[model samples]
Target: MSVATGNPVFETVGGDASAATVTPTGRTTAGSLADLAAQVVTNTTDAGTAKANAVSALNTANSAAAQATEALSQASKAITSSSANIAGGYAALDGSGNANVPGNMAVGASNSGARSFSIGHTGLKDWIRFQFYTGTGVAANPDFVFIGMNGTGNTDGTCALQGTAFQPLSSNTMTLGSSNNAWSGITSQTAVDVISDLNDKNIIGTLGNATYADVTAKLRVVWASISGVVYTLKSGQSGRQHIGVIAQYVAAAFKAEGLDAADFGVWCSTPKKQIVTKAVDGQKIMSIEPVYETDGKTQETQETIRYAELLSLGLFCEKLERADLEARVAALESKSTSSTAA
Candidate 1:
């Protein structure tokens, strides 16, 4: 370091040297031994002041921390005493067996599309509802969704998911039966009714009356086809007996009579499946609506015939035979009368 002498004034703070204090009257000249000594003294005093301030700050921080600890202890005590059942207290709990949250609980961070899930209770009904909201605003009305257990009782095994607008959910479809697996046959207690009202008919044409020859032919083939058998199913209906004619034999009988079974309304050999069911609690529930193939064609899976149509054809044979017998009687009576006159 290089030093030069000039009459520059240097500030000095020196008084009661042991205390390291400041007194503004003390001043010194530049480059003098007294001034250099005064600077060293001033630096010492500044360091002492900083140390004192640091100690005071430490004391203040300790006092604030003590107050905070006391506050936290009081709060914890309040919560424990208020509810005996809370925090391992031995008291009865609510029906849900869990502590209830005050407000709606949000689930999942809002997705990229601003959609999220929430669980809240409907105000009046006390119905607990799970919701999904779409709007970005905090006050936006959310869409109620998800499965819920309402206060009222419902039929067992019917579990459904309702979405927005209270509509049944249709997101995922289920395939009911596989190509290898088939559905069980459903039974109805009552006989199936056919609509025969005049308004239901299309007034296009009339059925031509059958001739005696046609009746005789149909009666012979149909009578042979009417044989029934008692048997059990391959899946075996628990040893129960069933009575029905073989549909294949019925079709063959019609073929023998030179009549196409396909041309008649009585023949029902087409098999179709459009039914689907939902599984709830390991039990199947038939609640899903039937969906058909897009091409409007039914899958061929069964064969059946209308017994009513076969019985009607048999009655026609009776009417024709009666007419033939009456005509013979009239001719014989006339001949007898003529013979008597001769």
Candidate 2:
């Protein structure tokens, strides 16, 4: 191609050219094209540097791809149910880094219906007991009662423990029921002691610290009110009439004398009563209910006579009356002897 034509065609390699006349289609002459040759050398150096950078980038991309493949393999193994290959551990799948919990632990029993907390040993005796053993064995016949909760399939859902009988830690200390609950029909051989020691007394005296005359006065008032009556019996008892003084009359007699019958311990007064919820009854008005008794149609406090106090007072009154009669007889005999001597 000619440079004078305004559109020059690229020349083939190893061609000769004369830069002095500016004809590019001919081979470039070495002596006349000094500045162009220098530029070509500089371009060759730049091309070599670019090729080296491309090769280095390709190696880095290949290494990253290999690392990504290895990470994917490890992640796949970690989520599996079996941990045989993951971080060299044989355990159940766990989120914790330590592979598994430190030691053996079981949340519940494997038995079909073993939902309730169960601790049993075949070597032990008949009771499937809940107890703490302090390296001691073979306790004697100690009274123990455990609360039994019957759920789902039971007819009665309520629990009752009838009396305050519990011994803690010791074989004797077994809690039978909650407060306001009682469990009866307990047959045990353990000895029960009623606390009545004389040492327990703080200020003990004869007949509630009453003087001899005071006792006699109380007994005389009580005897005057005792008018026995035969009244028709209730259905539970036989038709025979029962003889007893009205509790109200005794209370009235004491009131007339300006004294509180209850303070005297002659009238026993019971507070409002409560019947525990029965296993059969679904009605539970209160956890501990109050059932009041009716004196006629109106509610009234229940008061009963304590016959023991009354009987003791009567005996003392009889002794005093006998002494008075003996003294009268001795005086009468002395008078009769003096008259006979005159």
Top lDDT prediction, candidate number: 1
| TM accuracy, model 2 | 0.39
- The residue ranges of model 2 lying beyond 4 angstroms of the native Cα positions read 1-215, 271-298
In terms of lDDT, model 1 sits at: 0.58
True-vs-predicted CA distance for residue 311, candidate 2, Å: 1.0
Lowest lDDT block of 10, candidate 2: 125-134
What is every candidate's alpha-carbon RMSD to the true fold? 16.3, 15.8
Per-candidate TM-scores read 0.35, 0.39
Candidate 2, 58-104: lDDT as tens digits: 89989998999999889776755554534645455455653443344
Counting clashing residue pairs in each candidate, in order, gives 1, 14
